[model samples]
Target: MKQVVQNYKSGELAVLDVPVPGCKPGGVLVRTAYSLISTGTELMKVSEAGMSMLGKARSRPDQVAKVMQSVATNGMSATYRKVINQLDSYTPLGYSLCGVVEQVGPGIDDVAVGDLVACAGNEHALHAELNWVPKNLYARVPDGLAPQHAAFGTVGSIALQGVRRGEPQLGEVALVIGLGLIGQLVVQLLVASGARVIGVDPDPARCELAERLGAEACGDPASAAVENSVAEITGGLGVDQVYLAAGGGSNQPVELAARLSRDRGRVVDIGKCRLDLPWNAYYEKELDVRFSRSYGPGRYDPEYELEGRDYPIGYVRWTERRNLACFLDLLARDNVDVEPLVSHVADFGDAVKTYQRLKDGELKAVAVLFRYPEAVEEGEAEAPSVAVPAVRRGTSVPAPARSGRAPVRLAFVGAGNYATSMLLPHLAQRDGVELSTVVTTTALSATNAQRKFGFARATTDLDAVLGDPSVDAVFVVTRHSSHAELTRKALLAGKTVFVEKPLALTEEELAGVLAAVEESGNDRLQVGFNRRFAPLLQEARKQFGARTGPASLRYLVNAGRLQHGSWYLQQSTEGTRFAGEGGHFVDTASWLLDADPTSVYAVATPGNEDLQVVLDYPDGSTATLSYVTSGPSGFPKETLDLVADGRALRLDDFVRASVYGRKRWVSSRLPKARDKGQSAELAAFVKAVRTGGPMPVPLESLVATTAATLAVRTSLVSGAPVTLARGR
Candidate 1:
């Protein structure tokens, strides 16, 4: 596909041919209609004072120091090459987009071919020409909502979430301190909620536009609420609430909000503005100071949205969608007018002009569109790929399909540290599976991985595996986020698939994947909830599966190391570690307990990230899990304690674990099999394809557990424990 790219080497924007992203399971490929350019964000992103090389070195002194440290430790030549490569890579533009779903992946049921949807996540936005939005982050566009309006959903959601957190009460005054795109939206929502709004901006026109949008008053405020001045508006009592929405400023709002608020008033700081108030002023004011996060609770939740699970479509009314709908409602009610508020409408071309206009401050109000009409170049459209027709299952076939091979030619998708550090070492010793390829993001890494793992060849192209008919199955060890899409693609290409934990980011992704599974009509799906493969846990299950009484298990763990995973920050990749790692224990508990979790209650301490979860099932059996992503110093990674009527089993580090209460209290230990799990998981994938036996971990059961995992994240975010789901 011909695509728009920014050349950092030449500093020019050009259209060039690139690969159109392929569709994956539990995801959809989109063709862009319109994408919104964020003025304040993108301008700051690549501007002179910011994003430039010198600016970066000053802004991130620690990173610069790290590079110097690396040079001192490794060598100057290596360090210079690393930094230079980063400088050569051009940064992509645009994050919010609206488009039509062109192809649907497996297990996805909610959205279908030709459906209009809003792209929400950052990575998904990059594939505008042909994007694969994991079911987790894509929100269905409202029927009447314009594509332009849909394009703003993601950033609008961020603003909406901040406004919601301000907790504005009707009849209360709300002081919005900033006047950027987000700040303006926050002002509009507070106004929509019937709060008397006071808009603050350094720019004259932004304040004027806020006035036109029903702000009772607007100005470049030295103070949030002046005692005498606000007395005239509020009869001497300060504002009921204050919202710090400005960017880059520090301490000014902290002092202003303290003086401007009435006793026991609410101060929700929602922007990048800093706070460095004196202790005396803060303590004397007695205000409820709060920080607003991106979107509302359940924003990144997987169970509620992906895997085809719903957030009741009731009490949880809009979720991500409702936020967009609210923004649309304000627009439709004429409460917030973007048309007049918008000072720029650049087309999808001439992207450079957008940067120029933003730096000049000629862009104001809502800086919606980026490329200019005149500067946008007219180019020949790239030839679209001829899509293969969707094949309906259970229908007549043209002839007999190709015969199955004896020993499957296997390809493993991801080769990051885990693949090298864990899975590859095991796959090297396995049978019934031949390693042919290891795909990475770049050809260089793929080559490095190929030699290190003894693969015949490595290529950045996934089509190399998909196009090779000899390839029978795929073992996916990529970051958690891409698991669903890659698995879906593999399945559609008539290959058996296995993936690591937390099937997809959200229930939506799971649902879409389930749809793909249904479409495949093939029972060769498996999830690597590796704890089950641990010799100790497997024995615990074997022991309890035979008993009739209730069983219990505990995954005593320290979570510090998890914080280092970059994928963890990207929810789709690592998931909330609660689900990514802890959910595996949840699934293990369900297995050892011989029952599915019927309900779960999670409680987290104040100023803590760890959550204590209780999973209850029928027959009075229960399991407890401590979701700790932060750990005590020098703590062991994982341990499990299990029990039934008269028997208790202890498992530690996949090496030494034994049962004590019954059956002679046998004591045994694993002789440190470092990579048994990778081998076992692959063997299961191949076995499921060959013999059709029960999988080590059933996809359906794994899907259910993932839903529960998502529930825990939602509960934590909402500060309310989520109830257990019975069926799905």
Candidate 2:
């Protein structure tokens, strides 16, 4: 097996063909899939190795002090030999990795051979083809989570431990003084905990990336923009917590932490930064200083990590292994996204060159991964493509009698925030609805949904939900990547599917769903395009009356920034932002124009931060949709206008609407809140399910809207109008 090794004294890195580690008792032998590089901690070590002996001594005064004490005790000759031997020998690299178990030794029962697991520990999870990881240092990878993402478990655990140390609370303001890999993860964890974050970094690009990930504001540490943002968010009060995730010789991080922290605020050190604290500022604020050890309790303990000794959960809630599992669960549930943090994925054979580039500053990255040979081979296979079968209209299972039938048993495949807040809440207490089973990738999330929404049962077994004859409908509310696959399975199982919009990320996935429909002869499916069902917009369209000529429709979606760790930003795996959301606007426009679009043209800003999509209808009418993220948060999210035949209609963010013609008409302002039609949509869907009627939205219209939505991406890439093919 080949492993990455470094010589401290010679400053040389090599991918050496070393003996594969044996499957020791109380541990498992794993075949490496992917390994992560710690850009901050590992690079610092690399740079120190390249330095001369005197320079190395200067960089580590503590090691030098230890060396002097050793010399006094053991004499200069013995001490000198010991120090030289240690530096000249090859040392293994990497502390985090994802791999498939090849062998499970005695005393370990949690995992078995061939199971994928994320391993932690420098000695156990090295950058090698195979490793022997003790039971307590490895966690089973969550289902559907990519192995490359699981490789982030260790560093993610470190960030999670750091956030736990800070003791952040809901709605508190936090200032993160770094934007590196760990810092970025910390920012996301804080956001997930319901705290607002302000990020500081010297790199403008990093600061911008931080903001895109959910930071309220980010800028250079020296810039006034960061200070103003902190003041504005906290109402002139200092931030509740300050996290020092920066590394350097300067004293700025500690000083800034003291200056920005509120009175008695907690400051946690999570990185190897200069800690020369300024006494006066800290004394004035009386801040509580804390240090977060890597990966929480049991991190460096031999008994826990090497001997497989488990900690009592009642006393130690989160140990190293537990933290690893927690972070992996967060990744599985789409809560803390790491896909955006990945800058590069290099082959393991290029390990030496990759390290040199990073050390020489030739490569700029927040995080990098090493893909083993097996993973690379698997990745090279082409994704299967299937022809989209012809749409079979009005084909569905016969509905039972509407009178006194069992409540429509609906099973939800995901329990994320969107499902809980928008979809489940509407159906939870509805008279004719029964929340039967909630299936999630994580057991905890399934249990949470079962507890909150009164689900009959909760389990991670998706097969059980699909196979159950009593489950009348299945809601595919998981992340964008899983929608097509889940929907196809449910449709095959003869259950109605209510999937959230952006039905598919690619044409192939879309075709697969249609193929399933053709194979099963069932078209009982509804994509969650709730905008068309909005009562306010529906009423406005009715009041505007018919139009003889081509009408020009304008829809502006002020899609503001996503939270720092939103799964929506995982473009590589989940699809682009516009690809996931552009369907809603297209569907609504088609609903108003009363026809499917014949052509689509699209363009984007330089970094694809904003988009303008133009759709041409069969009647020569047109709709222009502008989706921008640079808009102010205080502004409304969705607003629309339609004008033709000397008449105009406007809908103000679903709050109010007006029509102008021979007789002017306007809607009364909505009192408590704006309704985007989730409740109404659910009601209509349930009614369709009970009566065996057609879907609320026609099957052809849904398919056309999805195809038109997909065309925008094609047009953006081709820089030309894409004509929508009508029919098979």
Candidate 3:
């Protein structure tokens, strides 16, 4: 139950008690035996995390650009909240580990429970007691290899990939320009390929270890005679290939590799060293230079790592997974010995101190391994999934467990920024509302949320929350990909459900959710379309109610563009903005017109921002939404203008409104804070739960809003208007 976590803001490391992760489909849960500490990569992360705000920005310019843009649009106050949320998060560490399978998820039959395997992948194979690893990121360890030795499989594959890039032939001579753990492994692998190897580093101990591990020769790069030594090792013809496997702030490794390589020789870089190359040094010799990607051919492909899709052996013989299997085979045959490379074996409980020593250079670790508690050979330890004991505020029992006028007991399946900042605060103070449980995938947040929000229990299991009799309704505020399934599950569990915007991403998922809602006879389902409830918008709607002519509304959203690698940009996880955040606008437009969108046409500039969508209604009214990212940052995020019967009302960020076409123009401003209608929305849901009344947002309206959003995406793809299917 203990996992290693680091605070990104302080770079503080600790071992914390956390709940075991649920087994997801296409993956297997494993109890860790030994996990290697990547000194080079992890130490850099620690140092960067400890940097000052300005320092951190200097280190990552792309992120700094995003922050500046956010400040431009949302003002300084709102953007600060977003930045703080990101910085204060607790992140897991380590990626190469050996473990025994504890549970197998659906579609994973290659390995079963109790099988010893080597696991890779940053999201999985973390330095924890238990991990959920995808099948492709795991390979069976050979019978006789020790857990400590097998844990080096991922690192060894990385070394193997660098050698493969060099294209070293049999009887060739290669120079490994770093005597670190990876450099030592590179030398041994080159020897296994029948090539004479030379290792170079500044540390004599590392050089000596490399020589002992099958390097024909070893030299310190700091030594003035190192270049001459390489020439002598290769019979005055220079090395046929050079593998630059050093990590430092200096560009010497790259310069040295280019100097020592023979004419037309290949130089493969696999380290975090400076990439500045001396063109003249290699151009004169006509040398070939290539940088080796981590592991091998399938490094960053989601289909290969997370989806269990393997490259055909005939087409790609040495994919990342295949390279893992090959390294284990070599270890089995005694071709590669990693025993001497391990400098320390620390207990998992003392991982924090071990990392401290490693970071401060107090411990010389070639490959430090964290040994876990003895794993059971039969069936692994049962993953912890029970609900945490309640922390009672008073002697009163929760409302769902009591009789008359009891408060509605609620459990939240996620604790994201929106739920924490917008929803929980209002619900916590509301009358007849009891916050029962809060669940998340990690521990620190769950514990933090429990203490901060006055929740009775914190857990990592959804089943525990769903099965609790004390819980009467569930809030689904997780990522978009999880909305449909989790909502369906809660409905089946006979609990009311309230999910955030964009009920479902696809038509099929929408249908499934609607079916589940029908099956829950008396229980209600509500999607968050909070804009319709905003006081300003509601007032505008009342004025439009008296008008008889067709209306035209224009919604402008200055949604800033996100940089690459942001979680929001990953459509599979977060869904497109149209299906995720745009639904709120669609619902607002439809609710104001009191008509279902009959057809939609859309177009967008590059990066899917600067979008223009037109929705046609059955009542002959039309709404135009211009979601532009290229707008100036000082502009309000959302601005709406509605025109009907020669009267026009303009709303600015839900904080101020102006009406035109009167004898004199009238304007009103909210007191403070833009009212996005979040409070009113939650109040409505609570009222319905207490009174057993109709769902706050009609199911048909939610469905129609989502259907229209999906139709916009379809229209953009086909470059034509997309008609909605009846009843969707």
Candidate 4:
């Protein structure tokens, strides 16, 4: 399906043909009829993308801090590659759309196929012909409501949520600061709720439009008439509540809201702007200040969004999905009219230029809508697929193709951040390895990976790579949920497979992968436990290899808190950081001790805090991992301490190691790069594939490490120590 995406590096907009995403459990696949472009939100993204690197940094200090942190932890070169990868990636746009449900994924019971639904969620309801929206992010449109107007449901929900925060009651007077698309909707909602409304904005046209939509009065925030209009509308008293729905970098909206609100009244900010309110303004008035999050209550809860969990109506009356449904009901009942707010309507194919026009001020539109062609006889939208020329995001090398030597050819299925940053660069440097094909979901990434890493060809079809007999290996760096299926497919296709950590999320998937490994003759699968091959760890192993006593290992991981809606928190995709990241430490400890863990126990603090996991080995050895997200940022992310045979060793963030016993010595930094074992692991896997040697790590160890990691989650939930069933 064709989707509109923006290139962050160059701020180039393009409608490119991307693979139709598969419907996962707890979601419904929708064929988009109409999707609305958020002028305030999308325009900011466009403006940010168009800025220079310095401008970008100034605009987003939070991201700059993250980059600095990356530089501190991963060194300059690795952080540079990660930042470049992010800049070159394509970011999809649009968060609200009305569509026909084409398919329903498993575990979703709310909507059926053929239902007309309005989809929300920026990550789900993108401006694409087809989208997979979670059950909680989509609602069935009310009967007789036009799909075009239903596309406004998400924005309407935002407006409704802001009004809800304002808490306007009958006979109350409220001020809506910013008469943009949301402000207009807010006006209608407040008026319908029996509240007299005054709309404020700098644009006269928007003010007039708000007045036409039943706002008691409208005025420019910069004009003295704004305060006069509010006083007049409220009979010389300020508005009972001020809803700031404006979008800009100015702090005036906040100041205006504070001034226009009556004493002890409420001011709710629903927009993205500078919030530097004067202390006296609120201090004297004793006003209440609150900010409304996007949509409603379930906006960022991964359990609510991805796992189909819902808050009871009695507990939480208006969730993000309920807000959408309520907005659709209002539209159908004629209480709210969004028809006049849509200033422009473009075909889905022209969405790129529409965004450009909107950003360049060539189009005077408040709400821009993109219309997809009606489904034809085949039940598919009639939108034409856009032909994007193949181009790599990174550097291009005119290297020669594979000669008669025919080195071990490798194919990479997912060219995401990890593959592009760590794996691909090292693979590019290897001698007897060939980057055969790059298969990614999007055309831009496929082309870029092919060009940058010298892949033979770039394609979106994973089957092409698996079917080719010439390809000797496949790397599965996609989502954790797909590791099992991809690895099984690659091994069955007679190719060596190297999958990233936490090999499979569930024991059932693990069993299937183990079956595949056994069928593939036992030397084809290698899990990414790169820390075992780190130069520092290798030297430490040499010191502790001959120890007769059980060693005590303590690993401290300062895994900073992930944002609420981050993909890492989405259990369906990444399955929490425990399954996603904790496996690395688990596997590393297993390799260092050279002993499989016999039991695992884990406990965590509430609200994204510290987690303590203990692993017990058969030789009475124990490894303790303290994973905390609330620690100071300056601390090293990973630190290791080991004690055995009257000796102690400390490894600080994998950069340096100091031994504290009779063999007192220290291994410090490498002259050029921090050797985190990524290069060494990749080289070992390639050599094994080429020389028919044993895999870098034994298959039994891979299975045991995965089983132990899975046991950690079980132990945390079961509140008991879980014993591993793997044989020694």
Candidate 5:
């Protein structure tokens, strides 16, 4: 697909053709029609992060501390590369849009051919020719809503989410502090909700727009008269609530909210600004304080958003999607007009420039959207790889899912981190699974691969093993770019294969390899979405049962490793960390719940605390991916919570898992060592090969897992939520 991406290295936006994303399980492919450009969110990203290397260290001491810790664990070379590499990569932009479904993948239900939908999350809702959205985030547009207008549905929902949190009752007086796009929408929503409202901003034009939206406009919030005006408007009692809409100001909003609020009034904050609040003033008034994180309680949870399972639609009918529907309803009814606020509209090619205008203060607008081409296209390649290193993994066990014995012989191609650190070790101990041959590009890597884990033989030539009549199945574990190539060659030779995360670099590659599998007529191609075998995850899945109703999961991954550095630094190689490591966590939750993910919207807290991605599954379960780094090492890479069956289950890393709740919290620890999943995952792969009844994880599930990772990448580059397919 032709999409616009920003070159993080030079702060330039480039429009290029990219491979069409493979349809993941429970996802729908959408051909994008209109995608909005969120200036506020895109500005800092299109430009440099504004912190020089030294300045970054000075301002982000916490980040520096984390880097130092990484250095301590991974050594200086790894740490230094992590620091320098990301500073030079490119990022994508845009998160909300309207598109038509072209195709739907396995397990998709709600959406079908020719469905007109608005994408809910970022990343997946790119300003591109095409998009792949999960089922949860895919909201069917009413017949009358225009695609262009519905594109603003996400923005309206974002603005409305804050308003929803404000919960302004009838006759309440509300002051919307910011006049930006979201703030503008907030003002209009407050007015429609029966609240007497005042909109604050330095820009006269925005204030004018607010006035048009039925809100009283005010100048500087810090001015004394503004407070008097609010007091007088409210019969000398001050407004009943405050929405900190205005951004960039310091303690003034907090200070002003305290002054403008009536007794026991509420303060709802949704902007990205530091708040220096007056504790005494607010404490004395007993003001109710609330911070609105995107769409409130259901915002970051997977069960509610992706799996088509939602909280009681009665209590929360207008979820972020519902809110989008609501806002679109208003627009469709002509209750509000967003045209006046849209100051600029440009081709997708100009997406970067639009963001530059926002950052440089050249163009002023409440909303600006990028227009992508009508068809999918590819973008420029960054230093095309002379030879993308091969990655692979394999075993002598074949069709274990249908059979109970190992295959004729085993061979492995492409050994990298996953092999060196994970699969190889597990294979060494897997009963009935023999690692007969290993392949790496270099003699040193091959020798190490062979000796470290006791492979029968190792060689630099991948074909040597593939050509061996003794070899039946081959394991591939190289970089993403080489996965399709190596797997295609191996499978073409009728070899059963167990690949790692992200089956291929692009959909085209995946199709080619899948075709190879089909040509080989072998149904034993397995992707290493290892979490399917993590005993703790299995227990969590079993405990959650089927999501007959609402199911929720809380996953906190101290994915402390790979903050930067390594080839993972290159987007073209491993994509982003989300696609590489984070995909495993996402796929695991999806597999357990077996729900189609509908919508994905994630917000990366500026200044990097790893990427905190919240996926919404159709089954009412939320996979809260807390990518936390720093603090300490050996922090049990992951912890999980499945809050269902009238109780919450906890899994501390893979080693320990338990259920809690009973007036006091109870913790359960699985009796296993830290590196526990490896053995089981390898064993399961062997089992799948031997039986072949069903790949432990279906090819559909493997694809979905990788797609989720790519969706996160879409979000990070685009700074928005990505939508996956709906019905599985």
Candidate 6:
């Protein structure tokens, strides 16, 4: 399927053929009929993307601050690669659409496979032939409503929510500034509520359209006509409420709003416009300022949007989805007219040209819609495969062993920041290693990886990479929730698998991977536990030597706060912070103790932001791991110590190490850069694949460490030690 995408680095727009997104649980696969374009919001993004690097940085100071923080944390070289990769990739467009449900996923019962629905959300309601919309982001369209008009549901909801914020009373006069797409809708909604309306905008055509749609009067903001209309509507006072629905850098909208609003009247901002209020005017009137967040009450809450969780109607009278449904109802009843707002309708195939025309000012549109190809008849559409295909059962084929001289061909499933910055860089230019293919959900990310790392091919199909017999190893560097399942599939396909930790979020997932190994008779697996392979730590252990008594180890990981909107915080789906990251510390501790843990006990600070986990080995040795997110940013990320037989080994992050034995020894000097042993770990895995030798870490040890990491959650819940089952 083809989707509209734009390259942020070059500002190049294209309709690229990418893989059809799967219909996951809690959502429905929708075949788009029409998709609405936000001339105000999307055009701003397109314009910003076309700017130079410096211009882009100047446009988004918030993003620049994040880049600076990343540089301080990961160093300049790593930050540069991450930033470049993000900027060069293609991002999707469009957030409002009307579509027929092609297939229903699990947990979706409100709408069926043939339902016509209006979808909202930039991530879900994209300008493609198909979309996967979660339950909370889509509402069923009313009977007899055209799909093109239903495409206005999302934007109409924005207008409806803004009007609700103003609390406009019957017979009250309201002023709506900036007669764009949303402003026009707001004008009609206010009039429908029995409130007289005055509209303001510089565009004479838009102002005319607003008046046609029920505004009492309309004119340009610079003209005295707007002020005169507002005063006349409110009997020489001012309008009772003001809705600012404009978008631009100019502060004229807010100033005009303050000038036209009655004393102590409400002011609602419904669009992304400048908010430089005229302080004295607003202060003297004591205007009640309110912001109508995109859609409504549940806009940014992941639980409400992605997890199918709904707020109680009593407490939250109108959520984003409810607003969407209400707007569609109003459209169906002919209370809100959208026909005048339809400025243009372009074919989906010409999406790139359409965007270019809009950006270059060749197209003047208040609202544009992309008409997709006709949908198939009801009951004809079959459910597509899920995002990740299930691991086939009863597989027993073993991969062909490779000669030592043969290059170990690798195909990567995810090209995220960690994979590009730390893993791929180590293997990209290495001899006797082949970067065969890079597969990602987005076509441009795969293409970016191929361009940067010399991959032989790039694609969005996971099956193609897994089915290829030439690929020797598959790197499962995706999100934590997928590691186990992807690893299981690769193992069943008879390919060596290297997955990043934590290996599995639950015991069931861990059992699933082990079951795959048993079914396929293949155990070539390596989890990313690179910290144990650090040269500094190894030297310290060598100097400390074998101990007569059980050793005590302590590992401190300053796992700081995640940035806002990070997927890591999607704990409902991705698992907890500790569940996803604790395996690294557990594996490192187990490696230092030279044994798998027998039991695990854990505790956390209030709210579970920080955790302390204790693991016990069979030989009476114990290791304590401290994972803290509230630590100071400047503090070292990781520090460890091992003590036994009157000897102590200390590691300061990965930069230096020391052993306090009979004859004291320390690492020569601090290294120029920190090496967490990613390169060495990759080398070991490749060598094992090439030579058909045992994995760098034993399968049993890997399983045990994963079990220990998972047990932390159980211990935290049960408030007792969770004993590990031995002899897997």
In model 6, the runs with Cα more than 4 Å from the true position are: 375-728
Enumerate clash totals for all models, in the order shown: 27, 4, 1, 2, 96, 0
Q: What TM-score does structure 5 among the candidates reach?
A: 0.50
As for candidate 4, its clashing pairs are 392-448, 393-448
Looking at candidate 2, the ten consecutive residues that score lowest on lDDT are: 380-389
When sorted by lDDT, best at the front, the candidate numbers are 2, 6, 4, 3, 5, 1
Task: Give candidate 4's error at residue 462 in angstroms.
Answer: 73
The local distance difference test score of each candidate is 0.65, 0.87, 0.80, 0.82, 0.68, 0.85
lDDT value for model 1: 0.65
What TM-score does candidate 2 get on C-alpha atoms?
Answer: 0.62
- The local lDDT score (0 to 100) that residue 672 gets in candidate 1 is 60
Give a tens-digit lDDT track for model 5, residues 584-676.
787777765676455565545322335677777765677777776543676667777777657677777776556554433433654446644
Per-residue lDDT of model 6, residues 1-728, tens digit only: 99999899999889999999999999999999889999888999999999999999988888999999999999999999999999999999999999989999998889987788999999999999889999999999998776778999899999999999999999999988888888989998998999998888898767756765667688988999988877677878888898999988899989888888878989999988888888999999999999999899999999999998999999999999999999999999878867556666667888988888889988778888787756322311211110111233355545576676778899999999999999999999999999999999999999999999999999999999999999999999999999999999998888999998878887778888988987888888999999888777878888888877898999999998775357775554577788888888888888888898888887665335578999888789999999998899999999999999999999998988899978888887664789888988999998888887778998888888887887776555433467676641
Model 2 segments more than 4 A misplaced: 378-503, 506-516, 519-575, 578-728
TM-score per prediction, in order, is 0.48, 0.62, 0.51, 0.52, 0.50, 0.52
Maximum-TM-score candidate:
2
* Cα lDDT tens digits for candidate 3, 234-271: 77888998888888679998888887888899988899
Candidate 1 lDDT, tens digit per residue, 99-181? 77889888788888877787766566652366677775677775655455566777777777777777788898887777777
Question: Superposing all C-alpha atoms, what RMSD in Å does each candidate have to the true structure?
Answer: 25.9, 12.6, 24.8, 24.6, 25.6, 24.4
**Candidate that beats the other on TM-score, 2 or 4, i.e. the better one:** 2
Candidate 3: C-alpha RMSD to true structure equals: 24.8
**Which has the better lDDT: candidate 2, or candidate 5?**
2
Worst 10 residues of 6 by lDDT: 380-389
lDDT of 2 by residue, 1-728 (tens): 89999999999999999988888999999998889999998899889999999999999999999999999999999999999999999998999999989999988899988898999998998899999999999999988887888999999999999999999999999999989999999999998899999999998767877776778889887878888888888988889999999997988888888877889999999999989889999998899999999998998899999998989999999999999999999999878877667666677999999999898888788888888887545531111111223586335446544555668889999999999999999999999889999999999999999999999999999999999988888999999999999999998898888999878887778888887888787788899999878899889989999889999999999999876667786665788788899999999999988998888887665345678999999889999999998899999999899999999999999999999999999999998688998989999998888777888997778778888877776555333467776656
